[model samples]
Target: MDITHRGPALPLAMMLALAACSEPLDFDLRGRMGGSVDTSQAALAAVADRPKPDDRGIISYPNYQVAVARRGDTLATLAGRVGLPAGEVARYNGIQTDDGLRAGEIIALPRRVSEPSPATGAAATGPIRPAASVDITTLASGAIDRAPATPATRTTTGTTAPAAQTGVEPVRHKVARGETAYTIARLYNVSPRSLADWNSLDKDFTLREGQFLLIPVVETAPANAVAVTTAPGTGSPTPQPPSASAPLPKDEPSPAAMAAAATEQKKEPVADIGQSQPAKSSAAMAMPVGGSIIREYSKGKNDGIDISAAAGTAVKAAAGGTVAAITENTDGVQIVVIRHPDDLLSIYTHVDGLKVKKGDAVSRGQTIGGVRAGSPSFLHFEVRKGFDSVDPMKYLQ
Candidate 1:
């Protein structure tokens, strides 16, 4: 055979050489695929190497916090909620005159760390002891003593036998280390003046630690009547008249019972008169009134103050009480009377609508009605000692 006839073997030789180059191409493809797989690992590793951001906001300072007052939240209630006394809260917030906190008002409550006791001279340490508990008891003495016989000639038919006046029992309190006269007075529901008077100390005097002081009790009574007897020869005993003395009825009501009965009666205003009675603090009378003073308390004509607002503006119960009366007078002014504890009554006049029905127990600063339309839109607030109207400003904040 000729050498030219060996072309098939030459072609086979060329195919073998191409197969050797394909092995290298296969290695390059495997490397590229491995490189692609390594890229995903690098991406995941890059994500894992990134830093995270802290989420906490600006840190707040110690002993400083904010409080939001909700609707119907009084200063007292707010203080109680925040573990503080109302007086301290008021003083801290620089609230001197008004306690009428508007809804959504933000109040600041400053925390104070307790200091070392001066007496002990110990270093300032440990948790602060809470204030001492104060118990308020009605200070009236119910004990009846012997009444000296009055002259028989000067007696009235309607007047019953006088009961001996009961002496007021003093409340005993132990002074704390940091206690002051004002603090004690506030805690005991007594006035600082009254507290001083009971202890016979100067108003500015400081109370010593472990000192014992007396707190005069608060009492509410009907009209205080003292018997004025004429001497034997003077004025003939005001013309003695022979009047039959009826035997004491077995079922007769006591003075308190009669007063309660009268309170239940719709017509008459209850009377609460006593000289030693402490007036309610203005801080305690924090009724909200969005109005101007149309008239102030006057000695003659207008006895109580008048607050002028738009018609239908709310008129709240000045203090806690029951709805005593709801009537329209000849002057076309609607009036609602609320009888409080201890025989006190508050009257609201010129109301357009009454929200509380008769005998409904309303709390202090409760909405009872609104001002009448076409009327002066004024609330004629009166504090009555029986039928006589006393000054409402004397007891308001």
Candidate 2:
């Protein structure tokens, strides 16, 4: 498969539209998180009749969309989906990282910014003014104004709760004996204000054991397990090098994380997007020694392109960049890492007789290393951005 012809098919705009939907989706909001979503429309309808986007064309809680909190849903897991800082989520949302989340309680996704809300903050519950319209049209959108809503007095009785104005449905929770306001809030993974607003309880109201209480929530679920697929690590030339340490293991990137990050962070490969159009740069690029690609790159299968060549074949620089690191792995294979432009890194693994040292400036087509003798004479080439790896074919040319 000539991946140069293949490109990132997922457009950026479509993804943003999906994330901003107001209704519960039949799909997992974190689809790349690697799990099924509670997409049942019946289950969704029961979650809450989330208000329609107001005149400003903004969804409720402009900062976030809600989901039924599931077992294992934590601030950290939620942060992983969009690379949120865990500490900020904990402090701003008043949630403990280790606290267990109640199943079926409302939870919020990664809002552009974390802020206190009537449901979570000390503010009393009432109708909050709609947030500024989210103009997702511009790829360079600004941060959401996540200011807390004005507080309202708590409802005295359950007939018309304070949060009722916001259209948040309540769940019935029978307060067990000796249960206090704080204990009840933790059990449901909800803020005390949310619990009080639902039942219209006074801030200082005492709860009797076994008393029934209503908890408030936005339907949300546990963060799904992010699927990261790595190709099986093939052994390089054997025997330890006297000057080099053992080979350090490397992990390939997952297509799911890659795609999701592309959607969320706009780190998509900037390459020729046309499948039928030949690579304009491939002709200008230098091959890392001419060899047939033994293992082609696959999104969910292989991490990078593997080219098979004779032992000791010279491995040239795919492109000019700074020699970032010349390290050995546990297998004694000398791996050359080059820091390139555009937040990209090119890795030449399983090579020996390295010509470049750490911090050496190399030019394009420079001989940085050579294949090792007495082992599979193949070069493992990878391209990466920050933490996520991508197909080298996109940029090798």
Candidate 3:
């Protein structure tokens, strides 16, 4: 049998074989076997160490307060002692869910006390008890007198925590470790923006331990009800700070509730496809998928807009960004988060399949996934500025 000459396979094989036969260069290792990192600064100088944080009863800072977590002090107990919400306290310290807090670590408490508003003369609303600067260990020691106030048992004496109030004593609060504007606001039933404005702080509203802050209080009242009081000559008003033990207001709807209401309202009708603006033609954005919006974002309810389309349709990135995460929720819905410039983030949810992975760099119109199969086949889209969710319409072109 005669062997016939072929194209490039024979030459390629020979070249690979030759390359494999060559030996890699090597260097002698005897002299370098005992190598060690050198640290000879001043010969006798000690290594630098982080400055220790205060681990005493309570360390105060700007906007929040902190205490060294002691034995037998869980996050719940600590939060109660400070007259703040347990969940809010845990969140400020980066704890999620009902997990127990860490011992020996610093804990941030809310701004329970604040200065009286100049116009109101009272501490915003009703009297706020003294700031929560208690020693968690002592409070949690099962002593009845030292036990902190719980949500169910919180009380206000002399000056009550009714729907409305007036000028009270100025209350003060010391900042604690790991506290932020959002957590502090939640504890006091105030808006983070408002808190920052009251303190003349920037939008960032940063907080530090040991720093003091003037808490701005809000007094809520029935719009129709009018105050009927005697003339000033009768007697002086009672002196009490705003109620520190007051729980969340009943009339104040939660963020989720408000968002859910908005979602329900929008569900009545879908946006017209013809009126649906094309991302490519509009601003500097791309459509994640061609579909009609089934749901739009409602602040506090839905964080992203929902688009419904045919099953297996491609989902593209709305803008150029790096893939930050790819996750699936308990409902088996796939989500992809992309980090963009200027501290912006784009999120795609309810995706059926993904074309990219976490950390992938994609272009403005790159396909990230496909819409999952559903009765209507839909996906959720969101744009966030930093950690705050913003409306997608502002960025979607």
lDDT of 3 by residue, 61-121 (tens): 3334454455677777766654568887766656643555444444555554332232333
Q: Supply candidate 1's per-residue lDDT for 332.
A: 53
The TM-score ranking, best first, is 3, 2, 1
Candidate 2 lDDT over residue span 292-317, tens digit each = 88776664335567788888787877
- Tell me the TM-score of model 3: 0.34
Q: Cα lDDT of all candidates, in order?
A: 0.46, 0.47, 0.51
Off by over 4 Å in 3: 1-282
Residue pairs with backbone overlap in model 1:
none
Cα deviation in Å at residue 270, candidate 3?
A: 31
Global CA lDDT of candidate 2, please? 0.47
Using TM-score as the measure, the top candidate is 3
Off by over 4 Å in 2: 1-285
